[model samples]
Structure formats: C-alpha cells, structure tokens
Target: MLLFSPVLSLLALSVVGQQFTNPVLWEDLADTDVIRVNDTYYLTSSTMHYSPGAPILRSYDLVNWEYISHAVPRLDWGSKYDLTGGQRAYVEGIWASTFNYRKSSRTYYWLGCIRGSNTQIYTAPAAEGPWSRKGTISNCYYDAGLLVDPDTDIMYVAYGNTQLSVAQLSSDGLSQARTQNVFNSPSNIGTLEGSRFYKRNGNYYIFVTKPANGQYVLKASSPWGPYTSKQLLFNIQTPIAGGGIPHQGGLVETQNGVWYYMAFVDSYPGGRIPVLAPITWDSDGFPVIQTVNGGWGASYPYPLPKRVLESPVGTDTFNSTSLSHHWEWNHNPEISKFSVGAGLKLETVTVTNDLYVARNTVSRRILGPASTATIVLDYSGMKQGDRAGLALLRDQSAWIGIKNDSGTFRVIMVNGVAMNSNWSTRSTGSEVSATTVTGGKIWLRASADIRPGSGRQGRFSYSTDGKTFTTFGNALVMNNDWHFFMGYRFAVFNYATTSLGGEVIVEEFTLTAA
Candidate 1:
C-alpha cells in the first residue's frame, strides 16, 4: 500500500541540493567510524550489546544516509546475551570500533571490543552482506583502529587509552604479530582514547580523542611509533545548544580528496549524535575542523556530489512480508517468537514481569528534535497476566498499553520502570491509572522533546478510536546518562507476567514530526 509520507518530501528536497547539518543523525548513533570505498561512504557505530550490533549506514552523496545492514546479526557472544538463567549483557556487547574497506582483499572489516575487552571481528565483501565472524583476537585492544597497509599488505591496530599501543596483526587478520606502545599522554591531559589509524603522503597519522572534550593527532613514521602528538580540536563550542564538544568519531577523505571529520557530540537524552565538519590539512600535515568562528558550523555544503537518499522512519501498514531494516530487536532475538505478515505479531519469548528482560521487544530510533509515533495495537490476543504496548524505552522507561489483569481488559499508563546496571529491574514504574477499556483495539502515541539540554520529558497519549487521543499520564524524564548509551527509542513490546504464550498485534505504526 502506497501511503502519503512526509519522509518523501524530506528526501525530495535533496534534488535542489542538501546541506550537511550538525547532529546529522539525530538519534543515538555514537562512537562512530566513517570509511569511503570507491564512490560510497560507509559508517559504523557502537551498538552496545543490542542485537544487530555494529550497524552499517551508507550515504551516496554524504548528505543523506540510510541503513545498510548490521555487521552483527546477533550478539552470539555468550549465553548472557540470551537472558538464559536470568543472565543479561546490558551495556556489555559492542563498544567503539574501527571499520575499514580493504581493496586488495575486496573485503570490509569491523573490529571492536566488547565490554572493554574481548576483541571481536567481522568481515563482508559488500557493506550489505553475508557477514562472517572473523573470530576474536586473543589480545584485547580497547577502542581499536585497523589499518591494512596498502604498501606492504600488513595489518596493524592502534588501540588503548592514555598511552596508545599499536599491534601488528597476523596474515589472516585474527591474531597479533607484535605489540608496541606508540604514544602516551601527560598526567594532566585526562582521558585520551578513540584511535583512527591512517597513512597519508608517506607518513602515518593516528587520530585520538580525550573522549569527553578533545581530539588530537599523533604522527609517526611507522605503525608502532615513537610518535609526536599535536592537539586538533579541544573544547570547541558546539553548534548544538547545551551540548558537549564533538569528539570520538572517524575522519574520511572524499572521492575528490577533500577531507571531512565525522564526530559525535555527547548530547544526552538524544544520546551521542553524529555531527560532520569539513576538514582541511595544515602545512605541517595536521587535520583541522574548518570552523565557524572557532566553532563547528551548524550547516555546510554537501560533503560529496552523489545521489541523494534520506530513509527516515515513516508510516507503515505492517503489510510487508518482512519488517523494514529500520527495526532492531532489544537483544539477540529468538526468531521464532515474532513474525510480520498482516501485522507485526510478537509472541512473548519469556515469562518476565520486566519489559527490559522481555525477548522480541522490537524498536526503532525516534525522529528528533520532536516527533510522535501513533500505533494501532490489536489487543484481542492478550491472555491473563499479559501486558503489551508502546514505550519510550531506555534503562529508565515508561509505557502506555493494555493489560489483561486477570482477564479483565484495561488500558493503563506506566512510568518510572528502571533497570539496574546489573541487569535486574524494578518498577517504581507503575500503572498510575487502571481504567477498564471496552475493546481490544486501541491507539497509543508518544510525543518526545529530544533537543540537547538538561531534563527533557516524553509524553504519552491513548485513543480507543484512531482519531482522538487523550494525554495519559505525567511526562517522564528521559535518560541522558552516558552509561545508558543506547538512548530513548519507541518500542513495541509484549511480555507476560505469568505465562509465555500471549502476544500483541501492531496493525500499523505512523511516525510524524511533532
């Protein structure tokens, strides 16, 4: 079914030409890396234990980027990822990574550390792929940068914090040949990390970050270096109001040799968001963020001259045989638990009172700085003790939905449900109103204010009919903490407090600018 969509108009504006804006991706796409292979630019971001970890996004013109595929189809790290025996991997899986395209072998490499250790790797021939797990490297290189030296076909990784280390990888790219400390920071510099390795003009450059507020360049003749360091960007004013400086991402050279730095700003609630800056090299071969009054510009000319495509979330009838690529499960999903045909039918995979541990809770990023998602939920299938609905999902979450309270149907608004760092959850998260509803079909909508600043809140509303909605409960504060790195998302979830067979049918979901 072809539906009139606002996203189509946004995509069409690019025909006249599009501008590269700050917070280019307005959601939680953090700890990013960008690489250009031929005419296309591919990006990778830290997925933080979410299934389909380490996402791959592509931009034909660098003005509009769309989802390609995830390097990790599932977080197959261990049983902890499966919620087996109540074990959880929250904030544990994939962290900062280095993504590269090697021309000689015609492969794309995605390498990162899980939970500050346990280095893992994945590779594919194309950005969208049949990916192969290249296996874990025995050495733990935190926040790694992979460089396959084109001159000699040797692979090297620049990793670590404060004192940076470079390790030469084996011919097969799975193990380390040798390791050496290449660069170190002074006691006062604070936390320095986020390394991206490169070779340009017969010299090597490793871009490193002081993660929270600064970025620096380390230069040397060899991968394992007695390297010299220079400050690149430090505490620069952010174009985003009340946001931190842009730091910790990758630098890419366009097809025409123009350079650009794609970094993320630690804007809480909305999470760490990607911001692009045009780059130029100094006479001494140091990279510079082409600044607007010594601060990154809010908008600039498009980074590349290519086709324009912006695939933002839009109206969905839930009629597709398969769900769109924009959707991702909370963790490694049991595939048999959910199906998309006439509508998205999510079968509860586990008997859980907490939504955080509930399996097959499907989600997608919210459109910012303000937007709303209205979903039609067919609640006829809910059994006793079943709760299903729409949520502003995070470690701290809120939901508005239907609860089959001992087989008595009710529409409720629940807020303050929080998950502990240890994976346990508690519900200060409560149903404020337990009003009985007349039907199994209902509509729920969440309106969010995600602009960068302190203390943003999300509001929820519900409708017995599709057109009219009643603002339900008190707006809940959103999680801006860096520890809850995935940020807030719109989730469609169904879980049972007593049994595992109950389900929910999401007939349609429409996302619109608020």
Candidate 2:
C-alpha cells in the first residue's frame, strides 16, 4: 500500500541538503560512537536493557541520522532478559558500545558491556544486520571500547573505573589476551568512563569522558602501551539553554576529509542527546574540538552535508506491511503477538498491573522541549478486563485508553508516579479516571511543554471524534531521576491480566514538535 506520506517527502528533501544546529538529535541516544565508511556513517550506542540491544544508526551527513538496525535481536544472558521467573534486567542489558568496521575482512563488529553478564561481541557483514553473536568475554569492562588494528589485525579493548587499561583479543575477535594499564585519571576528574578507541597517523587514541572535567583524549604509540592523556573539551559552551558538558562519544570524518566529534550532554527529560562539534588536529596529531579561547563553544556555525534518510523519531501511520525502524519494544518484543496491515494490531499479553513489566510494549523516544504525540486506537477487539492505551513512558507517566467490560466500554485515564529512583514497577502515587464510551475507537494525545523553564510537564487528553480533544488528567511533572536514567517516550501497549486474546489496533501516531 503506497500511501502519500509527508515523511517520505521529508526524506527526499533532507537528502538534497538540510542544515541542523547543536544537539543534532534531541532524543535519548546515549553513549554514542560513530564511524564513517566511504560516503556513509554508522553509529552505535547503549540501549541498556532495551532489546534489539546495541542500536546501529546510519547517516549520510553527520547531522541527520536514521535508525538502521540493531546488533542483537535480544539478550539471552539470563531469565531477567526474558522477564521470566519474576526476574528483570532493567538498566543492565547493554551499555556504552564501540562500533567498528574492518575493510580487509568486510566485517562490522560491535562491542558492548552487559554489566553483570560480561562484554559481548556482535558481528555482521553489513551495518544493517542479521548480526551473529561471537560469544562473551569474561571481562566486565565498564563502558568498553573495541578497536581492530588496521596493520596487525589484532583486536584491542580499553575500559576501567578510575584506572583504565587496554586488553588484547584473539585474531577472530572472540577472547581476551594480555592486558596493559593505560591511563589512571586523577581523583578530581569525577566519573570517568565511556571509552572509544581510534587509530590514526600511526598512533592509537582513546576518547573517554570525565563528567565534571569534560572529555579527555588518551594517546599511545602502541595499542598495548603506557599512554599520555590530555583534556579535549573543558568548560565547553552549549547552544541550548540547558545543554553543556559535552562528553562520551566517538569521532567521524566526512567524505571531504573534514573531521567532527559527536558527543552527548546530560540533557534532562530528553536524556543524554547527541552534540556535534567540528574537530581539527594539532601539530602533535591530537584531535581537538574547534573552540575559541582554548575551550569548545556551546554551538558552531558548522555546515553539514545531507542524506535522504528519515529522522530517527516521528509519526508512524502503520499503513505498511511491517513495522518501521523508528519503533523498538521496551524489551525483546514477542513478535507473535503483533501484526500489521491497515493498522498495528497488538494482542494482549497476560502480565501484572505494572506497565513496565508488561511485554510487547513498543516505544519511541520523546522528541522534546515541547512536543505533542497523538494516536488513534481502535479497540473493537478488546475483551473484558483488557487494558489498552497510549502512554508517555518514564518513571512518571500517564495514559489515556479504553477499558472494556463485557459489552460495556469506558475511556480511562491513568497517571502514575514512581517511588524509587530505579524506575521499577512499584509506584506510590497512581490515579485513574473513567468516562463512559459510546464507540469502539478513540484518539488519545499527550502534549508536553518541557521548554527549559516551563517546569517540563506532560498533560493527557482524549478525543472521541478525532477533532476535539478534552484534557483529562493532572499534569505529569516530566521526571529526570537518575535511576530511570533516560527520557520519556510515546508508547502503545495492550495487555491482559485476567485472560488472553484481547487486542488493540493503532491506526496512526503523530509526533509534532515546537
């Protein structure tokens, strides 16, 4: 079904040429690493417990990127990854990935830490992957970076807490070999990790972050070596109101040999968003962000090249036969429970009352500051005791949906606030409202006004006729707690606690930003 879509037009115009400003991507794509191969650029980042773990993004220009695919379909470490045996792996699936491609073997490799499970290596022929797992290495190097030396074809990984080290890997990039201490950051550096390894100009460079001290660069003549480090970005300026402290990302060079450093800042509500800074090399062959007065500024008038890829997050019409790359489940999605044709059909999965623990809840990051998301849900197939809704997912979230009891139905709105910072299922403040419904379909909208000084609040509304929307519940204070460690997202969920076979069909979802 070829529908007339503005999204496709956007993709075309973008490829012709488009410019972007600071904080290029305003979504929670944290712990990012980038690499350029020929005219295309590929990126990998930490999804942390989100299945289809280790998302790989593709870009033509460094500024605009699209979600291409994921390295792992689902983590199979323990019962936690499957949400079975009453176990969960929240904030622990995959973290801080390093992405690389080897021209000699024409293989793409991704190395990421699984926290308690150990570091995993995933490989694929092309970046958009049917990636094969290369088994796990016993080391749990926090925020580890992987590099395959071009000359020697030897793999090396760098990681640590306060004191960092580089360890060698076997030829096949499977197991670890000898280890060597690399750099020992000073105590005052404050929160140092997220290492990304690079080899250039016959020298090995490691880009790592020190939260309070900014981003640092460590250089060594040998992959396994005694290295010297220097501060790359300190007191860097940010263009956005609440954006600064650019740290934790990898570097990429454009087709014209122009280099740029892609990093992230602690942008709350939107989580850690991507930042692009122009980079140049020093006389001693050190990469430095183009800055005035020896410090990188908040923003630059950088001219970006263009690509024809769609933006990473936006509206989904569900008119296609398959789901788009913009969507990802909260965990490994139970694909058997979902189908798509005219609209997205999500069958109910029997689970607890907590939405976080429920399976098959697909989500996309909130494009923030001020944005509104609207979805049309058809609940004609809902059975008694079935709960289906459009949710703004975070520790603190609210949803508006339809609840059916036998032949009777009602539109219900629920607001929940998490108690613990861990973003667990338990919530202390939860409220609900119900109104009699006369039809089998409804349109729900979540409008957020998170502009820096606006106090970051999200409000819920519903429309039975799809034109007039009525505000239903209290404002949800957009939360930025450390435990959730991320931003809110627009999610569609249908679950059953009493029985099975209930389903919800989402016609379309539109996300508009101011």
Give the winner by lDDT.
1
For candidate 2, write residues 90-153 as lDDT tens digits.
7778777787888878899887777755888889999988798987888876788888787888
Q: CA lDDT of 334 in candidate 1?
A: 83
Each candidate structure's TM-score, on Cα atoms with residue i matched to residue i, is 0.95, 0.92
Q: What lDDT would each prediction earn against the true structure?
A: 0.82, 0.77
- Model 2: lDDT equals 0.77
lDDT of 1 at 384: 87
Candidate 1's TM-score reads 0.95
TM-score: which candidate is best? 1
Query: RMSD of each candidate?
Result: 2.2, 2.7
Residue 354 C-alpha lDDT in model 2? 75
What digit string (tens of lDDT, one per residue) describes model 1 on residues 165-259?
A: 99998887777789998777888776788888988887889998996889989988877777888899888989788888999898888888999
